[model samples]
Target: MDSKNRAKWACFGEIFEAVAQQGIDELDAVEALLAALRNGLRAYGYRRQFTFNESGKVERLPRDIYPQPVPVAIWRDSGTPKGDLTSIWQDDPEEPEVWISIDWVSGAVESLDWELTNFEHLRTDFSAIRIPRKEADHLLSDLAGRPKKRAGRPLGPSSPWEKEQVAAALRMIDGGDTRPATAIATGLTDTALIGKALESQQRRLTWGIKTALTGNAKNSANNKRD
Candidate 1:
């Protein structure tokens, strides 16, 4: 190869190596930061309360720490129940660690993994909460109870998005929006459902009993005169 071409190839290889190293460094930094946060949250005892196991019947944790009040199960199969919290690397081969978020207020009972955001105080912020393997498995099993329904039309009669639109329309009706049925049938969520309904109601389309009576009286008087 020409010297110019050889030099270009060497530069490309060096660039690739640097990019790879940067990616690795980023992952390592994430891991280290989360590890420190999780340890601090646990040490503070904010989320160290005993909780009831819903899946396996009601049972308290054996080594419960918080004594004043036992930890209550935040959710059942209905809503998104609390799951194992952890800071796991995306490239990690092992399963995610089960952890809990300790609320600073009670120091007992765990919170959801998502409550921690960058908006909170860094030193006082929740880092991570690790749950035991058994608890993690139980939470996972509970989450898997209901099968996720498909979003788009999957050989079914109606799609989930369609259902959501209809539901939104009904909500508009309940809110006293006089949106026309035709507009609602169009299946626009924010626009047709809410906006159209609001516009329809602004014109006072629904005839009030008093207004109807007054109109009839005026017509009757005109007919008598004629």
Candidate 2:
């Protein structure tokens, strides 16, 4: 290992030890390790490309120009359920001269290894970093329960027309109108935006109804006692 790599490994070791000392769960430790690796690689002028194999179909995830932390659920979903998962970081998108590979089996990290190809002689004898697993099954279950992030350009600021439509839909919903009826009346075809606007209102309406029912039951009990 070169002096630069030795320094990087030392930094990683410090981070790993700090995370382990925090008494965090296995999944948290794994996430911390990944974050450390990504940050270190970014400092080393590496561009990261994420990909996963799902049901034997390999698909590359959207490339990130910035070093944004990817969610663990997305990583878990990239592989077959209860199967192996791998993430790679390379210095180049077309042809990477240096790269790091991390492999996981059912939410437990199996190996984290890196290689440098620019040397006069190929160097592939780096030892892998192994993290012991105590709650692999639990980790997998938790990851499965977490929602995966939708891959696409996020909706920008709502236009004035959209705001007006959402307001009209909410008003109709408040007046006991069904969502479809509100949509038809307001001419707002965006069901998703309407639903999002109504989410808090619906929750509050449900809570209010429950409270009213409970109050009625209490009044009836008082009347019986009287």
lDDT of 1: 0.34
Model 1 Cα lDDT, one tens digit per residue, 1-226: 4666433221212322333454533233223323433443112222232223345323234543431221222211112212232221212236422333332112223332222453321121221223233333332333335354458422211445544555555567668867664454443433434575544332222222223435667998889953
Off by over 4 Å in 2: 1-84, 106-118, 125-129, 132-226
Q: How much does each candidate deviate from the true structure in C-alpha RMSD? A: 24.0, 19.8
**Alpha carbon lDDT of residue 117, candidate 2?**
46
lDDT of each: 0.34, 0.39
What is the Å distance of residue 157 in model 2 from its true position?
63
Model 2 scores a TM of 0.20
Supply the TM-score for candidate 1: 0.15
User: Which sections of candidate 1 miss by over 4 Å?
Assistant: 1-157, 187-226
Candidates in order, TM-scores: namely 0.15, 0.20
Query: Candidate 2 lDDT (Cα, whole model)?
Result: 0.39
Q: How far in Å is the alpha carbon of 142 misplaced in model 2?
A: 11
